[model samples]
Target: MISNGVSGNKYMDGPDQVVPSDTYISCVPGGHVKLRQTSRGLASEPPISVPGLLKRTAARYPDGPALVTKKADGKWHYTTYKQYQERVRTVAKGFLKLGLERYHSVCILGFNSEEWYLADLGVIHAGGYAAGIYTTNSAEACYHCLESSRANICAVQDKKQLEKILSVRSRLKHLKAIVQWEEPVDTSVPGVYSWAQLMEMGAAEPDTQLDDILKSISVNECCTLVYTSGTVGPPKAVMLSHDNLTWDAFVIGEQVGDVKPTVDKIITFLPLSHVAAQVVDIYTTLSNAVAVYFAKPDALKGSLVETLREVRPTRFLAVPRVWEKMYEKIMAVGAQNSGLKKNIALWAKDKGMKHHLARMNGQNGTTCGFKLARTLVFNKVHETLGLDKCSTFVTAAAPLSADIKKFFLSLDMPIMEAFGMSEASGAHTLSIYPRFRPESSGLILEGTETKFGGAVSPHGPGEIMMRGRHIFMGYLNDEAKTREAIDDEGWLHSGDVGRLDTNNLLYITGRIKELLITAGGENIAPVLIEQQVQAELIHIGYAVLIGDRRKFLSILITLKSKVNNDTGEPLDELDTETAKWVAGLGSKAKTVSEIVNTKDPAVHKAIEEAITRANKHAISNAQKIQKFAVLPKDFSNHTGELGPTLKIKRNVVYEKYKDIIEDLYKE
Candidate 1:
């Protein structure tokens, strides 16, 4: 039996319980009901609740380090599994004492931290759904999520986050209390509590009510709400049951491998509000009793490397942008080298690339040159990046370009790619090493089922459909959309175009919704074309394709520029790497305005040449870019041109640049 490795508990390997999802979420008549009632994969990995997983880990490894954090003294500290469980219970009791009703949401808005995890599980333990709002969200966006989730209590990390809620507190009709988990809270405000105060309240309350609620926790009910990044429209709350989270965590951990009780370590730096981070940093670690180190609040702002160097985690997962940023920094540093040092670096990279390509092609790549390269350069690069201990390197959330993948491979780092949506609880296909081909999303998770629909050929590209226990319950409170998402047969329509090769490796082509149709009735996937443009011109931050029943495709390009860390807005100044690249191209332009206003000949010529090179790789003449315009500013979360996950918001871009697009299409 695929037990959670804990025995003797009556809940362990117990029969599944079907809870009323309508209380917390609304689904089609048989959406979640059918999955819960199905016995196909349920017997493989038994439906274990989140609370049960926590309890099992605590009991199985009482002394294991569950959570690690840095203190004021700059020393790493840890909370043992036993302590973590107790603290979760305390936080749960506190929520109960604060009048959190059953199925109500305890929405959390903050960076990943020990308190973040505590409050998350605590809310679920108190019989409430734990919803997370993106840290980059505006007060209005926060208000929408809070109101939609019907949150009873909202947790913020610092004063800034708390201020967002405070600005719209009166509008949140269902919100009863606010807890500032990091900074001090002004308790004078009614219903405002500090982290310490929340814990104290929980400690004072009897465990009778909390314990009773925990006993009634069913695996079939929604416990977490993953809000989509809302690239298309208003964010839809994807309701995930205990089974969805726990089963995914267990199966994903098993697939990635190397996860063990207390031995492995992983740094939590990605936004936990995203499903990928939630599964990898929180649930996956809990499932395997792996130690989780919390990155600093400024982890995204260059400090992530410092934390990584110190933590030296055993496994690492990063979004495509993060990996790309690292690549840029490495490239910048390598440019500073000269003479024999540069020669050695180049030689090592050549050897590394050859070795990686050979291995990827199913050959023994471990030759003398590879060994020498590892000793001379690759090993040092790994040590500096603190990935020396990392066995599994994963990239997800967005598509990674082939150029960036090969760049990392040349440094002896093979980054695996996983593909899925929030609707599937993080990942459906994971690319593990030896089987991980560039741009391929590897194989589907063992228990999950995937098929291509509407394809002309059996293995041809089509809409990717999946069905399994890992599928989410439904979009909360939208029966129509839920029914639209999950068909009568219970298969979730991904709306993503993909195909499975003979080797069963899934390759994602593009989003069916994001496709651009020409007036000539030709369909073009913008992402691949956009990626090519960006790959050819590393200085381009974003390339948005615009053509929907238009004559031909045109693109809006943005130069790589600085961004306001506080606001997530792109700044006018060019980023350092972009500046260097421009200087290398014989251009004196330093800012985006300089290049756009001056139309610097060197910069313009370089971009045109790059686009020409990219177009040559297009399958057809209709797919090539016919015109382009450079935007004054880069796309950013603040400007609403990009989503929280850094994926381009195509509609927002098109609307914002309508005038320029019209000008480009003019006869």
Candidate 2:
């Protein structure tokens, strides 16, 4: 029997209880109900496979645009579906010629690029397993992933990545070849293959053999091994079958409304290694044959503006941090502007808020004043931010602050918050446009099932457990961990803490493992506080909750940048001014206080207000952030306090600031 998992739970019984119309909406046109009323029997047929889905999609849209990237000369290069397929076959043939047999793992290490996607498809097309390492990973971390995956070949982007690979080449017995995308000054390393040479070799081969190989590839074969963005320790390689990825693309596409490339364009910049970017940007784009544009890494802001102006993309995906940054930049611009421009911007924002509130209350059309406000004020704001043409703006990876969500919605850009994990092929729940809850992560997808672990209080929270066809096969070579995560019944235990509203909309609270239990038995989720407080604090980059097994919650904050003064001015000014600003605080605290209060009052007040706002969202015991200390620098993965994905390594942070935390507790 397919275990529904939740026993004796009235809420788990039927579609009416699990999915209400008020909470969920159809992802397809005409808003037809999509979710099943009852769970399908265990004996039901399996869904279509990933490779088969790709082949079908390719056949359907052979002439459609598949990928676009900026050329070295700055012009955008477009690759059609037919051309993309040809390149994949050529790369696959090259891989086989290089002696990379089926199931032999190949790793790709780089930032977001067209080549990254190409290499990924090539590996899978060649019947080999593809793995991706974070660009920020150190040589040691790189070696650990490569060794763990038993990757024999690595496709690297440039010289820096090449150096990381070269550093550990002696110890990696399985590593037989290195494929460098960019031209290298020294190709002296044995078995190092240039990308150009490999393509040339593949071009010389017959196309018939490549076609046969692609056809022979099966759906059950492992296509990708994505290592978890290690927030604490070494990364775990999550094995994803072709079927897993294709199912994810199909489901996500269905949920977001059928995307037509002939009418829609997508901007791609998030790291291809990340599941959100991979599934949403690469696989989804390929499935639809949508025109996907690659933005330059160094000049992202300028590149984004240029790309948006040229392509006028209708859809885009971004993490909450990027949206937050956009908000900050817009606010900063308003702060700097004067006269009519400033008044117009502020007026438009007010009208936008009114329109947003009315829309939230189910008003179908905008008021005349709101329309005028949009044309005069918000239009400029949207154009300035390159979101004026966007039809869909998706936010994942982290929970968005309610205010931020509302702000975007006010701008007429509905921010669809989604919830998923690396194990679930990137999506499980998605907020459908025009029928979305600003606070909830929307209803679970049609084919997915969710169960609560225990009796969460009537409106309180519990662990979110899910089971679906798109769920990953298993973690590579780690059965114990796999069993620990996905039980014998098949439910993948998501480590998040969240609650379901009466309407069954899921509202994520925080990570279960990150929740701190106090000596007084009060539990606190640091992320909830961090999100609120960080929204307020412009100078603070990260905030770690202290006081585990203690009286109350305290905090350790990392400042964005060190400064000699509290004023929002550079410290590199005249020595006299720097010394004068640094002398305000008493001797013992002077040095640290000067470093902590770098930004101006507006920023400082924003942070303090965020803390206050966060407090209102918590209970009495969790409300008090009794004491706090700010470090001189931000926490970063390169600095060992955070993982590559910016998740704070709690133990590492605690260890690094043990003295400060102890002092806070004592105080």
Candidate 3:
């Protein structure tokens, strides 16, 4: 049974119910399953404020590890819930002593760290709103968000960000204080405060005042102002309330089968500024059943293995790129193996592909022969990748390839493909565990309503729309944009092109705005064609379709990093003779064709076959890639061609390659 604390409700009891010992009742919908003995219960009611939430969580599980940071000496430093609360309170008191007031936004500009989370909570606890700016944001973008949010105080990681703030401080009238978390630098700017000094000041103040300030906060008040990645234009601040955040945490917890913070360790690597990582990773720590771990930014690859070995985390949430990199590594290893091992891997992959095809066609289960083949062959591959311990794997931000999904599931790691946006507070829908549908973004989450708008073809694809409690309050100070996004009926227009199947699973096809209407007036979604072609080949990084309202469709492709010969070599050496090398390679067209045809027949055949496949899926005028160009370098966030979340900036790419695109269309 599930108890509301105020009242006992039978709705909480089910096979999936998490039952924790020590009166820690897991409040998942559909009832109580036994949790681990070490798990402790926090408050039954959701806290109205961030500080209140921390207070109740700390009191319930004082000794449980709340935050874990890897030290420079490679040791994990664990901080208990009580100690974490004390730090937050101390910092909150310090901010009050500095004369911070209610509704004043405090900006946190840094990478993921324990201090980042602590400062965020401290600012909120001191009756101020928390605004997170991405570490990679440019000086102009940073200034825009800070000034728009009306931030009076800023907590920065290092001298670089401090300098940026210092450069623009004179223009920002509300900017009064600057808090530096790292070692002090030679900043000539006024009103700069070191974090150590602030802590000392907090220690000198009375604790009662800090407690009183926390009590004054309400759930309806805005807790955070997270700016969107600005893939389209200038970033917009998504105002999130305490209720909004807590509700997101609640739904995510329910979806993942009620995670216990104390027993389950989660590695935090994604930026804390993003809602997906913050609400899912940090907020889950406050549940007292999960312990959060941090890794060094510079040594991510090496630190991942070290941290995973030490922590053995039960759940992992990551973007598609991480998994894509892992897939590449696995393929590289397979290519290097010899003799019986290589033969066995080839046979297993062939069998796995067949199994995957059957599964996609709605087969109930794998054939007996395929099952035996997998058990004998692919199990080692899974164990070697350190994926044996992963209980719940989820991928978001971009569409996941169906092949990648199948390969992981064959290795006994069923990944849940989720769909979300910054406006939706991170999650819109997730594939249910043990019953996942590959190539689809699963069913809409409970308490969320979805609809379709604009003109739909006979096949039913259209603009995706959503309305839910998890939706953001509005884009901060952008009334026109906010009004345009959310309709009179309260539905948030997602601008994505997709359709729901008969089973009600959502299949995201492409971006509606990116759809091309041919000269013959037929609408074509280029992404569908691009995804099919790209998934079948390993060389393509990104494919952009041209010929919108033109004679025919063509494409421009950015080559994958593995295929780029210039990669990993010194820039000076490459730059000295790049033209000569490119000319030499171009002269050997016959040899290049032979290599492409022989080494990767699949890739060569895919390109030839994709033209036919894409033509069948489109109208006569909108069919096929009439011509194409392969770029030597891949698009990336650092190159300004892709956003932080890895979405391609079409305008940037188009403008940079306009001459090439124009040449492709010429007679």
Candidate 4:
């Protein structure tokens, strides 16, 4: 009953095929056999719940490391699969002892942590829906989720997250108990219990009781509520069932290939609040018994290099911004080099690119020049970036620049880009290995049916509708939004504009809600223009297109600082090389504001050049950005302008800078 939506476009796959109780939009060219074969895995595997998967993995690999966390002393704490299973069971029993009813929502607010994940798994095993909240969410955003979910039990990592809940605790009519993971918590506060106390209480509960509850929990019952990224509006809770989560958890690897247990290393660094991360890190790990390393939220920036050196993960998953920052750092290093080293760096990069191009064309015998270039440049770069053995780098949750993808590919890193939304369970499309289509989202996932709507054509992109086993149950408590998103035909309207090529490669153009129509009737996809600008402009953090119904398009841009973009370090924390690079650009600003807000000629010129490049790709004059303003600060999750996954909240930005946007039209 799940679908992406139907397409009537000429490019529709296999021509209006009648799927039982659903209409398929199109099939990928030559996708029929592979797609059908891959779809069989969903049923081939025995149905299992989250707890059942954990038990299975634990039984198979009792002594193998399941969870890993690093400490301040550069020591790693390992939890074996058996231990993890026991901990999860103990925690689930704690939920029962805490008076959590069946199918009740339990919100877990925090960053990536052992306890955070344990609580989530435990909640579901106890037959409660676990709604994860981003650590960076504002108190109001926190209140919205807590109130709407009607959660009785909430687990927080520290006082900061606890206070956000406490600030609006009065509004949570059903919330009764709060569990704090870290110390220094005033347990004197009514209903505030420490992690130890909860574990103790859980241990006291009968193990038999928890087992019976897990048995009673139906696959179709809601067990998790994932909130949308809320790019265009307020976040809505997407209700997904045990079946919705577990079905893909079991079958996801079929499309991406197997995730070898204990052999492939993976770092669980992304926010667990996001569905993509949950699917990739949690379910994937459990399904294949993959060892997961957890990076402390506060120490992530300082620890990533050390961990990467130590773990040398075979697989890594990240958003586009992470890769972009990595590219920026590499560029910054090159900028600091001079003379022979600089020339060699340039030459090596060129050769690497040439090698990639040749390999992509199915040339196995690369020239000596490419091998030498890789030895001289790409190899060293890979070592420094701790990507030496990272066979695959999976990117999703936002648009990834092809330039970035190519850059990694040149360095012999497989940068596989994927596209999906919260409603899609995890992903709609994931690039197949070895044959990457640049700028495409990849072929449709197995068992997923896709189509285009709203005046779409073979050549023109349209809203992508998908139906598949991967789709979610519905929006939590919001029947109207649910109905609007999923049609009667059971297709999930993706709200994303995309087109499939003859090769069946899916190229995502933009979001339907984000398309800007000019006064002259020219419809433009802002994401396309933004990506173009970002690609052309060095030191650009993000570019927001600003023409909804105006005469012409304009853009608001944020500049990158010398500090590491991933860590969000202060200006004073800039590295020596980066600092010198910034100073060389005639930037004397100390703070974020002084740097971005200052009238620097270099920044202005860079943006102008970027705009010029972006205009080249515009289909019409209206699609081109006529004016641009450089903002002092970038959109972030803390700033309420970015979703948990770092997708821009266009409406929030538009409203926050309404005056600034209006000023652009004045002159």
Which structure among the candidates has the greatest TM-score? 1
**Alpha-carbon local distance difference test for all models:** 0.84, 0.69, 0.68, 0.74
lDDT of 2: 0.69
Runs off by more than 4 Å, candidate 2 = 1-51, 207-212, 299-310, 337-343, 455-461, 502-504, 562-593, 597-617
Candidate 3 on 201-250: residue-level lDDT in tens?
88899988766655555554456778887767888887775655766666
Best-fitting candidate, measured by lDDT?
1
Poorest 10 consecutive residues of model 2 by lDDT? 25-34
Reference-based TM-score of each model? 0.93, 0.84, 0.81, 0.88
- Order the candidates by TM-score, highest first — what do you get? 1, 4, 2, 3
Off by over 4 Å in 1: 1-43, 455-461
Model 4, residue 191: what's the lDDT? 93
Query: Could you give candidate 4's per-residue lDDT for residues 10-62 as a string of tens digits?
Result: 23121112112132221111111101113354544445557667878899999
Clashes of each: 0, 4, 16, 12
> Per-residue lDDT for 133 in model 1?
93
Question: What ordering of candidates by lDDT runs from best to worst?
Answer: 1, 4, 2, 3
For candidate 3, the TM-score is 0.81
- Greater-TM-score candidate between 2 and 3: 2
lDDT (tens digit, per residue) of candidate 2 on 1-667:
1112232122222111221222111111111111222345421324444445556657887777778887879787778777777787788788777777656778899877777877888877776778888887889989988888777789998999999999999999888888988776356778888898778878887876655555555444357888887664678888776656776787777778867854578888776777888888878776666778877663233355666667777887877767876766665566678999877777777787777667756798876588888788777777877778887888988777777787777766778888998898898888776557787887677677888776642323577888765677667667567666776566778988777776557888767777788898877777767766766654455787786899878777664433333222223222332233233322222233444555334334544566776677666745577666766555555567755444567888888878777877774
